[model samples]
Target: MQFKPVVALVGRPNVGKSTLFNRLTRSRNALVADYSGLTRDRHYGEGRVGTYPFLVIDTGGFEPVVKSGILKEMARQTEQAIAESDVVIFLVDARAGVNAHDHEIATMLRRAGPKIILAVNKAEGMNKVQATAEFHELGLGEPVPISSAHGDGVADLIENALASLVNPVVESSEETSMTEMDEEALEQALATEEGEEVSQELFTDHRIKLAIVGRPNVGKSTLINTLIGEQRVIAFDMPGTTRDAIEIEFEQGDKKYTIIDTAGLRKRGKVFESIEKFSVIKTLQAIEACNVVVLVLDAQSEISEQDAHIAGFILESGRALVVAINKWDGLDQDKRDWIIREFERKMRFLSFAKIHYISALKGQGVKALLKSVNEAHAAAFRKLATPKLTRELRAAVEQQPPPRKGIFRPKMRYAHQGGQNPPLVIIHGNALDAINDSYKRYLESRFRKVFKLEGTPMRIEFKSSTNPYKDSEK
Candidate 1:
């Protein structure tokens, strides 16, 4: 496997590092905002500039002097991204001019330098050339004036960055590791257990793709860090520390998994920033792309409408779901009891989703949460034979037949499994269009109960069976 040259986008917060990142990758994966330090982790994305394919790492704002708290951790992550990268696009805000923090970051990058490409972002038109004059004091090189927002001079910056990596490159060791891991992954095929044998097909053929999602500040990033046993993402006290959908691949006990950490979503009224609006769309896209979605909720408070909205979207997308209540290590028994009662009253619709109370900070109850994630993935991909599906549909209709609509009684003639991954089933019948939402819900419930699809979504499609003789008659 050939390794793409890794390029690190380093700068202070809100300096258009993420904006430049989005421009380069052609993806709004990173969250962008006017607020400082919105991005607290190193987000990785793949991009190409004029056929030059490369990897890009968007690091959080680089505050060089912070010695304590989350800023220190952010500094550490940014430095690590720089160290691993072959080239660094040192982004600066032309609008802000040469600030103290920018100078500090410049000094740090100069000392621990890679091939640095100085980019003066937000500099457009005639001001572009003059906007880079102040950055000359940083002593990196001639600043590449570019507008990340409008794609002005961005391609030139990328071209220069890739040009620096053309010659004198070392062979990567990632290919060797991949070869060894692939061999090991294949060796576990059809391995025998203590008594019963577990098929390695679960590990080889399909790896669980899980997404961690919830409202802002609900420990979604923390839970992913705990599960992966690494601080791969920046988890901070800030309400929206994570701004992008970060995907990390790893293996546990011979089983492969790709976990996605998405931006926390707030209600539309509260969401004011254009950047956050983009983040919301990315989170929704992530939910649709994943096999399972872990809906993390704050255990300290009752479930809110934001949680319900997020859940409704997940169920509507027909993705597997796991409800994880975080911050469960502390609190009195009464609060726990209240949470249960609140769920029973407000969230009974999610009875199909397995719920776990966990402390993401301390990694409590996380293993069981992952077990549920795996089970839910399997349930979502379950395939039912034609005969079995027809029988189950007949049983479901017998229990609660669709009520007569005025003069006509909707009939469920037969059913068959149309697809898997949220098991889509097609129900053929006469007057199926008359069946209302209530009947659809009833059939969905029956499908879950009969097929044992406990923690995943199931979809039902109604179709009016066509008559073959109609073409000749017409």
Candidate 2:
């Protein structure tokens, strides 16, 4: 697999690093405010300039002198980002001038040994030479004056940054050229009935991006370390130990997986610190980026509303889910029964997901958890034949036709596969706009049963047709 070059944006507090991040990636994923230290985690985003695509890392304030508390952790994350990046964009505030902290960061970057691009931000209306004059003392290189917020000289900055890549951006053709036989097979697939064999060549193996997420200190890091057979991430006993979203690539048997260990999420009301609030945002972004989610829950404690909230967000995101109740070992039968009942009562909506009890500390049920992850991934991307889908839809309507709303009963129609990753079934017919929620759920259940779409969310969209002649007659 070809990997994009990573560009790390390093700077002190309130130096417009996040602003430059949003400007480069063309996304506001990194929360930007006037306050300092708003970004405490390494937030990742993808940016493409025409055919050139690369990954960008937005880091927290780089106070290299701060040796204690969250500042030190943020400094560590910036260093890691710097190490992984092919080029580093050291941002300095043009208004603030070259400060002691900037000099300190520059000294460290000199020894770090990545292609460094010194960018002078907030230089919108100032003279380019006068704006970049004092930054020469940092000794990194000639400073590139640009305003992150005003979009001045930003594209040139990115082009220069990507030019330093060891492996230049070679655009891969996305168009899949199919042979005549493959085309015929695809045509037959649309007409094939349920349980019939389709072309094996239609499917191909690729890496699965899985994310392990949950509340703070719920053994998420422990589970990741146990899965990779190493203490890769910090698995400390303290809460909020893992602050950044760390991606690790490893293979189990023949399957390749890139597992992301993300920061813990706290309820909004309980999140008092601004850093934790930003951590929550990064966690949510991680959930959005992955193909499957492994929600790690604490088996020792009662199921909290926060856990359900996280699972609900997963469902709303339409990603495949696998629930892992961690620390299942050493629990009494009574406690286990109580936990099961609590889960059933609270997480009844997540019945489509596969659940497992595992002890990450003891390596018990780990294999089964991975098996469920694989199964969920496959189900999420599974293809459904249109003829089979339509047949199943007809059978569902026959068993229990939709009830009449006033004088118009919703006419039944054929269904076809519209998308994957949360298989979308589009039903085309008249009066579909009047279908009730209960009937929609019923159809969903029927489709889920016939298609065996377990461990993944399924969606049904109704597209109503209009009668052209009725308008003229009226």
Best by lDDT: 2
Off by over 4 Å in 2: 1-196, 199-204, 230-244, 263-278
Count of clashes, each model? 0, 0
TM-score to native of every candidate shown: 0.52, 0.58
Alpha-carbon RMSD to native, per candidate: 14.0, 9.6
Off by over 4 Å in 1: 1-204, 230-245, 263-278, 467-474
- Per-residue lDDT of 226-327 in model 1, one digit per residue for the tens? 887742433233233222245677666766777765654443212334235334334555676689999989989778865776777687668999999999
**Local distance difference test, each candidate:** 0.72, 0.76
Model 1 alpha-carbon miss at residue 429, Å: 1.8
lDDT of 2: 0.76
- Output candidate 1 Cα RMSD: 14.0
Error of 1 at 262 (Å): 2.6
Model 2 CA lDDT for position 88: 91
